[model samples]
Target: MSHAQHAVPRRHSGDTVVVLALGLAAMVVSMMQTLVVPVLGIIQSDLEVTTANVSWVTTATLLSAAVFTPLLGRFGDQHGKKPTLVGVLLVMIAGSVLAATTTSLTWLIVGRVMQGAATAIFPLALSVLREEIKPEKLHGAMALVSGTLAFGSGLALVGAGLLTQGSDPDYHRVFWLAVALAVMALAGVLFAVPASRTKTGGRTDWLGAFTLAMLLVLLLLPISQGHEWGWTSGRTLGAFVGAIVMAVVWVITESRVKEPMVDMRMFAHRPVLFTNLAGLLLGFAMFTQFIGVSYLVQMPEDVAGYGFGASVLAASVVYLLPTTLVSLVGAQFGGVLVRRLGARVTLAAGACFGVLGFTWLSAAHDATASVIGAGMVIGLAISFGYASMPALIVASVPAHQTGIANGINSISRSVGSAVASAVITSLLASKTIPLPDGMPALPQESQFTLSFTIAGAAFVLVVAVALVGLKAAHAPRTPVLRKVTQSGTPQSAEVEADAELV
Candidate 1:
């Protein structure tokens, strides 16, 4: 049968179950992305390591995810998404168990590296939805899964807080939680998610994958550690230069290869390019809110004069959690908007909301109400942006390339986030108020103002990218031919019949 002739399966209760299972799995994997944030200090003390050394708990995961996500994604496209997904989950489970059982910092970092493989889960899940779901239900399902990712980051913060509440706390408790979630997700996938029928049969692009991984590592390593190494340090500067050189070689290699790991031509496509660009900016905006709000609220009111002095738990519950929950609703609404208005409009609207939120925080961050309210607005913006991204990608790429395309987009977001972390840390650290005696210095209030202003401007750029760049470039084009029925009436069919038959 022709690809188009394959029966589109009817929607069933089982499909909903699959969506939930996948969404939950995505959420669980996403939680690992930020699960170490709240307990970094505890881990430092417990492991007898410096803050710089301890930071690798998060950095190792970031680097591992950056290196592996695209590779595994392409592997899924070549082999099978379900098996790749299952294998990734099992690895994540082992990672969690290892972390839960280990006290050595090296072992913990290894475990985090294993957990980083979960990054593949997001794109793999997106590919699966495209293959399994009816066309009519795909957008909404994608939205829920995308939104759950953002939701899971916030949920992880809260979970970390709850896990580390006691005076004598163990960081391993958090990994144990990850183990439970991974096991559940593993079972759900094994039982509910069907085997993959969509495959792009080809030899794996080892040379291309290796070059791409090196480029990502060189690029992300500096971004994650630039603050510590000094932005102008030799190591940081050298890595950036090396990454550029590697990228040039990778492009040449990919052009020569039979089946490239990442189609460089896709980057030239206006829709794909602009969508990835927007993903980067939106990712930056989202993390600014995430890391910014969390830090802003935790500043000691007496020392900083601008903070509410909330604990990690308080910040998670009172400030971030509500925003994340609202994002879930916003994602559903965004899915509806995509179905009705289109992805460009939804993306532009989200960027506009983000501008408003960041602008509010920039100008009026004195009160708790204002901070939380701004967070809620940005939360909505995040959901809308996240919901629209995959839809735009899927619309632009062929089904066979869906896994790697989405994977690239995911990496774009990660790069944005890494940049934001470095920028925010530098900005806040640049201007600090000295405290008396033994008290640690605090960032000046102007620093927060400046940071928020920068974020607001970034959102403004997102709006411009969405409205100007995305609209003209990514808009759907008209088909070459019109379909006609036996009655001689034109029908809006996707495919054209042979002229000879007619």
Candidate 2:
């Protein structure tokens, strides 16, 4: 509620326009996470690179986001959101252009690394919502924007499938689409979103940023590559141990710093902490739904002993689109729910939905309707879960801590995604369908059931985190609720006195 927490100025643009601009930017960021999923094979073949080298296309993005999101998010809090957002968007555009034109694996990976930084846009957009939107309408706006993360991720799969459908699949088309999205997002932000009116001006915590970046790199590197590197191997185990050591060092460094990049108290605050735990579980469930369902449907029924014999396009459009649509629609309602029911109830509800959806998926994925319906239900869970994030964050921390607090939350989810990706890959590979000589083996049908079961378990833990850890927290402080002054600013009382939730 402090004056320093300005997202964008309301006087410069309508709330709708500003929200849309941030949402578009966030959507583009989400797309970067999954843009190359369907095109990796083509990218490998066309570039004549080894499978291991081509895989870096995705890993580079994963590691890059882990390193840069927190750094740039804190940078925005210190410098100004407009410049930070503009810088990140420009990087995305340049990266997209590089990726679109690249014929070399090294450059393609470099491009992906640049694109990954756009993930910082989500936290920045949320912080902007905190400063600019009134509390009365803020939860809804945050929910709508947060929902884009899920919708955009799903959209990438469908789009990638269509763009790469024909025999001569042009990998460049995928990056070109990214360029278009980044351009539109950049335009929306530049034209509609106003500059920040307030900033938490301070010295950059370079040491803390470095330590945190190193921690994330140590953690995510293994999760993303553990499948390729044996789980028991020295490199994988050593990275995990190193992450633990770096985490302790990062904490000590932050504690002693003059201007700590992240506030340890805020990082460990119950509501913020548990909300991030919920975020991790949601991330796991989401990837589980996407990777598990996609891989399941694509299995050749006759040869694989179980599956729909679905093509990749059919998998994306028929099975997954319903989920994406629900994430959009459910989010609007989720915003309303967060306002009426509180973040605790909203998150627990989302977890309940996740349990239901995953149970259905595990028990009855024999028919197409069952697959699509289960996914849609899970999408509702994602919508509600995402909607709860800003509410919890805003309520828990001061306005000055908005960007860094949310940045860490974003990192938590990224970590969850990395773990889920590694777990799923290892699980599916653990038990494969037997095959004739020279033919590749498909995953055993039981692996899908097991994956869904494990995902449901993650959600169950989210329910506990929401109900217990977030039992009571403060409400978000807003500016004066009564009157707008002539200068388009609100005449306000003390921010702490106006706290809403309790």
Using TM-score, give the best candidate's number: 2
lDDT of 1 by residue, 1-502 (tens): 1222322343344888898889998998679988999999999999999978998999999888988899999899877889999999999999999999999999999999999999989999998887777666777888999999989998999999999998899988999999999999999999999877655667889999899999999999999999999999999999999999999998999999978899887656677788899889988889989999889999988777779999999999899998899898889998887777777888989989999999999899889999999999999999999888888887766565779989999999999989999999999999998788887778898988888888888888888887888766433322212111232322222111111000
Clashing pairs in 1: none
Candidate 2 ranges with C-alpha deviation above 4 Å: 1-13, 475-502
Candidate no. 1 TM-score: 0.93
Candidate 2 RMSD to the correct structure: 3.7
The per-model lDDT (C-alpha) reads 0.84, 0.85
Which residue pairs clash in candidate 2? Answer: 7-128
All candidates: TM-score: 0.93, 0.94
